[model samples]
Target: MLERWSRGLKGLGNWTAGVMDAFYGALGTPGKYLQDFLNGSWLGHPLHPVLTDVVVGGFTMLIILDLVSLIFGANFRDPSLIILGLTTLAGIATILSGLTDFKDTATGDERNVTTLHGYTNVASILIYAIAFFVRLGGSETTGQILAIIGYLVISVGAFIGGHVVFKYGYMVNHNAFSRGRRAKEFTPIMPAVELAENTPTKAALGPTALVLVRRGDVVYALKETCSHAGGPLSEGQLQGGAIVCPWHASHFRLSDGAVVHGPAHTRQVAYRARIQAGQVEVEGPVG
Candidate 1:
């Protein structure tokens, strides 16, 4: 059933991708900037999932109030409405962050699953919006019913969100488990003089594929696979002091592999390189 739904989502996304691209592209530089900001490039974590807790928590409170009203026969409409309104506002913010991340997804299962997650959340939000208005009109019974339905919808949405993270590994560090080589000694791969200054050179040291950069006397080494989506960093261009991933445009500092720009929240694996007997030797991860 999940596979069928995922396929359906892919079909829908394929049909709408062009329109979405044009619409998002119309936002231009400002849109890109906002997407980066919401993606938490500075915070080193995805902001959408964090903000979701606020919106989900607020609605959960509404459900509790509904239960209280039912059990005590007390009028809790005012508190419930207030909570719903606040959550609705937060939900809007969450949607913006989520959409920003969604725009970065490629056309495949990841895109399909993410689209389905977005659609489910939007439907849940709409249900809550209706409940908010109904409560404002003093239709307590109707509002409570809508709120219950919305809660159920959102629960399913939350499950899909979890699947996006755990099952598909969305927004996770692709090289989180890669820790250079098991041996601590530096392993020579190639002659240091062969590496061009300011150019990325791909070299393998034991099991690790690395991109080595030489800057006069200093040599820097980073895992060749991008931490985000496993994009090949060796093919990426070195701009300023950072290497930008060709696949997603994620940037990591050449000095320490820290994320200088994102869609990528984690740092790339940094390895220490030493010039031993004129050969570039890769040591364990940078300390």
Candidate 2:
């Protein structure tokens, strides 16, 4: 009964998210352009967090301002109600940006945590809306009381959001530590000497599949699993210095895992490789 009731309000978020999708969708190319912009192709990270921090941080400042007013009377005089208005607008924008990023995440533990975070934030939004309205009508003692409570709710929502990113690695696809050697410093069962020149060969490293490509003296190694949707990039066509995903045409530079093409903005987790004891060895950079 409680779980169902907890999820009961989720419809509000879904409805709000659907409305945002439609609004952004109607923008057509401009919408896609905004999505790419929010995806942080330029920043090399998801941008929702950046905007979210700004929104939440602004509200935090407002809370402090109110506290100061309550403590040091004259210095923080008449409540303008501007803070609540700005908070409402910024909160709504952050939710929209979060929804866009959330949609791209694949179904997994990360997605579940993200959904929870979103709903928590929605609850905070509701709490804030109520508080904002009360204050907007009249700055009563009860209004101040509600604002304090809303502040606490927002903090909890922020905590949940932090957990989704910091604890669960919501945006990160693969292990990026180990000196980039998890996929590189492997003792390949396939003979290195037998590898075809200027060609990518399939090799097994422990339980993971990898694509080993050589160009004269420099050998490039990356996970055969494409980070976007697990498409087989080993079977993908090689062009210039990148491997193009056959499924989505997402390209990753072999030298480093940087994506050189669209739809896939994340790196492929590159590895440093060498020939040791007549066998191919691969490893990645340490985190």
Candidate 3:
């Protein structure tokens, strides 16, 4: 049932793509740096989820405070009001970070799912905003009811957010699990001449698919999947010794697979290739 509803969210994706794409493009270099900081590239994980915990905690506590006040006829309004303010600020921060990440999401089904997750959270935010105003007006009865409703709406948003991670794999490094696990022996997948200079070529070594770009005698290899959203690197363009993912334009340096630009915080798997008997052979990890 949930799957059906989630899938239906794609109907709104086209509109979202048009609106958000412009906002994303406006962010230039400095904006990109700020986006990365908010997304938590420095912390090695997404900041949205971490900040979301605070919002949820604040709301949950507010609900408890309201229930306690109702049950025991006590005055817990001060703490409830304080927590609501804090939670509202935290929620705003989470939205900013989340939208930064979402702007980079590649299109198709994943974008649809992400769009749904985003707007659902927006709905939850609106509810909480209303609850805040009501609480500020000293209408305890109305404020408490709105708070409970807001929490429930946010809970639904939370469920969809979990699906975005566990099911759709957002803000995750698609290549993290197999970085250093490949066998340490050189394996030939194709002739060195087959890969053209400054072009992405696809080849498979054992179970792994790699994108190889040749520059003179040096063939640079990285996992074929983009670290962000698993976009196909072989279909991407090579520029300035870096491969740019076609979908979201995440750039990784071919030499060491370091992220030259992001949405992708983690490095792609790098492999060095040499010509063995006139064929291109890759030997495990690079540097």
Candidate 4:
């Protein structure tokens, strides 16, 4: 049903990937910083949804105001125009942030779904922009009709975007489901001798997988799954005091598993590690 329709939109992903790659490639490190900001790494949550709420709310109000002006004969033009202008601005911001998040999406259903979600929103924004201009030209009836049309398109776009998150788990915290089950006591994972200094090594405590790194006598352990996209942290490279996710290059500090850089807004679950006899025992979600 819906899955079939989403699959039909997969071609949009293929068509946009190369263009987005070139655009971001040209920007380099600054682009990554921009992405981090847009992804809300600083705020420890995604920014796209915040802006989306504003756009959706504004448009919803615009529809209400337009309806009042039509049916009740009240003068709501000024307020409606103001809401439209603000919503259009929010829509532009939403596009920027959404694309920034989308840049890191893996190929297949996630990418395909995000592609359709993005372009649909873009179409809605364009329509709203045109409606804004039409309203400014004193054609209230035509502008209202265009705005209603835009709202309908954006509603469809919002549904697809919801599918991307609620269904496919795009931009979801990989560790969300595991938060309550963190080690409550020190659990032996591996032999202390087996963990090499500065090397990312995989170990497990009960059902929880962990990545351990030794720095002299100190052993640092964090959840093996990258919080961003579940990339195995054991396979990632250490940069100074941080572990870099192999999948998206998100850097989580080894000391406390704080995200030093990201597309990942959530912190990796950290653990306390120690050598009890010859075995390395780890516990926590120290972060």
Task: Please give the CA lDDT of all the candidate structures.
Answer: 0.83, 0.68, 0.81, 0.88
In model 1, what lDDT does residue 256 have? 90
In the range 30-132, model 2's lDDT, one tens digit per residue, is 7766776666655666667787787787677767877777787644323436776677678887877787776655444555556667877777777777777
Q: Tell me each candidate's RMSD, in Å, in order.
A: 2.1, 5.6, 2.9, 1.7
lDDT of model number 4? 0.88
- Model 1 misses residue 32 by how many Å? 3.6
Which prediction has more favorable lDDT, 3 or 4?
4
Best-to-worst ranking by TM-score:
4, 1, 3, 2
**Taking the tens digit of each residue's C-alpha lDDT, what string does model 3 give over 115-225?**
777888888888888888888998878888888888888898888888878876789888767664375888888987787877899989877889998888888889898
Clashes of each: 0, 19, 0, 0
Top candidate on lDDT is 4
Ranking 3 against 4 by TM-score, winner: 4
Cα error, residue 101 of model 2, in Å, equals: 2.0
**Ranking, lDDT, top scorer first:** 4, 1, 3, 2
Residue by residue across 1-287, what tens digits does model 4's lDDT show?
45656678777777676666677779998877887899899888899999999999999999999888889999998988999998999999999889888878888878877888899999999999999999999999899999989999999999999988998788889999885247779878788888888899998887888899998889998899999988999999999999999988999999899989988999989888888898898877775
Better of 1 and 4 by TM-score: 4
lDDT of 3 at 182: 70
Per-candidate TM-scores read 0.92, 0.64, 0.85, 0.94
Give the 10-residue window scoring lowest on summed lDDT in candidate 2: 175-184
